[model samples]
Target: MAAVIDERPHYRPARGIHPLHAVLLAATIPLFLGGLLSDYAYYSTFDIQWSNFAAWLIAGGMVFTGLAVLSSLIDLARARGRRKQALLTFVLLLVTFALGLVNSFVHARDAYGSMPDGLILSVIVTVAAILATWVGFSSLRVGVTP
Candidate 1:
């Protein structure tokens, strides 16, 4: 076989987020999702412990989300360009964090009282968390435009 000429354009080096930051961002999804699941279990079974589990899970998710938001901010500040896209992901994370906080509060109420509202908030927060994670990860590239 004849050797073929290979050619490619050189581009700027890729920069990426810290591994820990990525872990924190990834962790937010499952915890929030778990909270949503727990809330649903409580709703369907009327078992109070499930709500308690949801509260704790929400609290954990908030912690991870808060860290992820801060880390993303640092990453955003360091990177030039792509502000609009990054900002959208950042906003989604912020919304998820805020809703998770509120959900935690709702879960603090008496088991019966926290029901529908807590369940609803859990759903919202979980969706937001997933959106945030998806946008953040999907939009990031090593050395290319997102």
Candidate 2:
């Protein structure tokens, strides 16, 4: 009897970050930065009325991105096994979301009027956004196997 040998490549489905998550991650940094700039202009320049429009628009975008991040985080948490990178990404996303909420509220309500405190919140949101983008994209390369 001759021994049989199998010669076939094992097939495995490719898994990675979801496209919606990628889109939201890509959008977060720019929106946060734009919000920061708009807030700066609104607070710094005394006669700039148009800055308020830009600020509000950016704030709305941030809130939308925050919701997307939360959705992605819930998906990550539901996955089986230990996903350290994904968990880290989720934490970063949470931070970004929280900061985004605060920033949006401040911008929408024009809280603190023209005071520089709003600018401070904008700066924090920008930093959190930057970190979230960095972690979220880096985790994409790691890939998740479902």
Candidate 3:
């Protein structure tokens, strides 16, 4: 039993980050930003409505990404040497979702420029992400402690 448990490692087939993950990440950022811009400035300045499209795209992308992140988190926890990546990915995805929620309100603002909403959100996300990454990396080094 011990020999089997400690045998030389061999690669096992499994799913990893697919190409679609990158596509989703790329699409979400621009879509959410554009949505906020249109809601706050573009529509007011010009007679147009782009928010509906941007909002839909951003929402769909984030929902898909959130699920993917959760799946990867589970896989990473089970796979050797992949846990840190998984935890960080989960945290980052969460931060993106948080920012998206904030941006949704920012778009509703009448005086968007006067407020530093974007900067504040960036700082909040950055701090939260840094903490999450630190905890995750440290756990990887320490192993799963009881």
TM-score of each prediction: 0.88, 0.74, 0.49
Per-structure clash totals for the candidates: 0, 0, 0
**Superposition TM-score, candidate 2 onto the true structure:** 0.74
For candidate 3, list the clashing residue pairs, or say none: none
Candidate 1 vs candidate 2: which has greater TM-score?
Answer: 1
Per-residue alpha-carbon lDDT of model 2 for 4-120, expressed as tens digits?
A: 123223323445567877787777777777777777777766545635764665666676577766866776777454377778777877877777776666665653463575678
Which 10-residue window of candidate 1 scores lowest in summed lDDT?
Answer: 1-10
Number of the top candidate by TM-score? 1
| Alpha-carbon lDDT, every model | 0.84, 0.67, 0.49
Best by lDDT: 1
- Model 1 over residues 28-122: C-alpha lDDT tens digits? 98999899999999999998889889989999999999998998887778757667757877899989888888888888998689989998998
What is candidate 3's local distance difference test score?
0.49
Arrange candidates by TM-score, descending.
Answer: 1, 2, 3
- Model 2 bad stretches (over 4 Å): 1-14, 48-51, 78-82, 110-114, 142-146
- In Å, residue 116's CA in model 2 sits off its true spot by 0.9
Query: Taking the tens digit of each residue's C-alpha lDDT, what string does model 3 give over 1-146?
Result: 67645552543444444445444444444444444554444345542344454445446645654654564466456755566666666777677667656654553454434235643543453344344334433433322222
Better of 1 and 2 by lDDT: 1
